[model samples]
Target: MLDRFTMPLTHRPLASMARYLSNRQVTPDQVTLVAFLVGMSALPLLAFEYYVLALMAILLNRLGDGLDGALARLSGQQSDAGGFIDIGLDFVFYAAVVLGFALANPGQNALAAAVLLFAFIGTGTSFLAFAIAAKARNVERPNFPQKAFYYLEGLTEGTETVIALVLFCLFPHYFPWLAGLFAAGCLITAATRLWGGYWTLR
Candidate 1:
């Protein structure tokens, strides 16, 4: 939901960084792979109960998420394959964080993590499915013109999810409650995306 605003604010800085990296011959795909690897490190950190360290790793992953896209555009190397890699790994990373929580304390967090993962299916499918149809129809998302594909606006977007994850890491004991709340938001996003996408497509 807040992505529209946050993206523009980060663009300049990310662009500058992208330009520097581009000069160094760094490719977007390379940045993406490194980011995913670093992000995956959070799983072990979380498993070992290093919440603060895990949080830092997660944040770096998120930063790289943005940076890769910026680098792609800056270096004029944006490709469907690159975008596909970026988004696909994103869902994996998001779910991995939840799994990390479950692994950290299975008795308390497993069920909640499962529920959140289920909710993710709803949001993820709705987002990707609509993007495909929208792209077919030449539908545009002015709010996210930089995006590789059109997507429905929703209550639970990348920004909100990151905030929820940050909170989860900061207060691991509250994972169940936080996961429930975020999962509920994902449901809302899914419902709205389904409804809005249907009408918009028609």
Candidate 2:
């Protein structure tokens, strides 16, 4: 939901960083790979109850995510392959974080984590399904021209997801409540997207 608003604020900084990395011979794929590795590390960190360190890993992952896109655009190296890898890894990272919280306290967090993951499936499937159809029909996403996939707006987006993760890290004891709340939001997003996308495509 806040992604569009935040995109402008982040564009200049990410572009500058991208230019610096481009000059240093760093590739977008390299950044994505490194970022995924760092992001995946959060699972073990969280399992061991190292919330702060896990939070750092999560933030760096998001940084790498934005940087990779900036670097792709800066170097004119953007490709479907790069986009595929980036988005694929993103879902895995999100799942891992939730699993980490569950592991932190299975008796309490497990059910919440499960519900959240289920909600994620709804959001992820609806988002991708709409993108696929939109692309097939050449539907333009004017709001997010830089996106490789057709972008859809909803109550829960990347911004909201990250905020939820950050809150989970900051208040580990509140994982159940936080995850449940966020899951509800995600479900609402999924439902709206499904309805809107269907009518738009129909």
Computed on alpha carbons, the lDDT of every model, listed in order, comes to: 0.93, 0.95
**Tens-digit lDDT string for candidate 1 (11-82):** 999999999999999999999999999999999899889999999999999999999999999888888899
Candidate 1 lowest-lDDT run of ten? 144-153
- Model 1 whole-model lDDT (C-alpha atoms): 0.93
Among residues 3 or more apart in sequence or in different chains, the pairs in candidate 1 whose N, CA or C atoms overlap within 3 Å are: none
Please report how far candidate 1 places residue 133 from its true position, in Å. 0.6
Error of 2 at 57 (Å): 0.2
Candidate 2 clashes between residue pairs 3 or more apart in a chain or in different chains: none
Off by over 4 Å in 2: none
Best by lDDT: 2
Q: Write the per-residue lDDT of candidate 2 for residues 39-146, one digit (tens) a residue.
A: 999999999999999999999999999999999999999998998899999999999999999998899899999999999999999998998898899999998999
RMSD of each: 0.7, 0.6
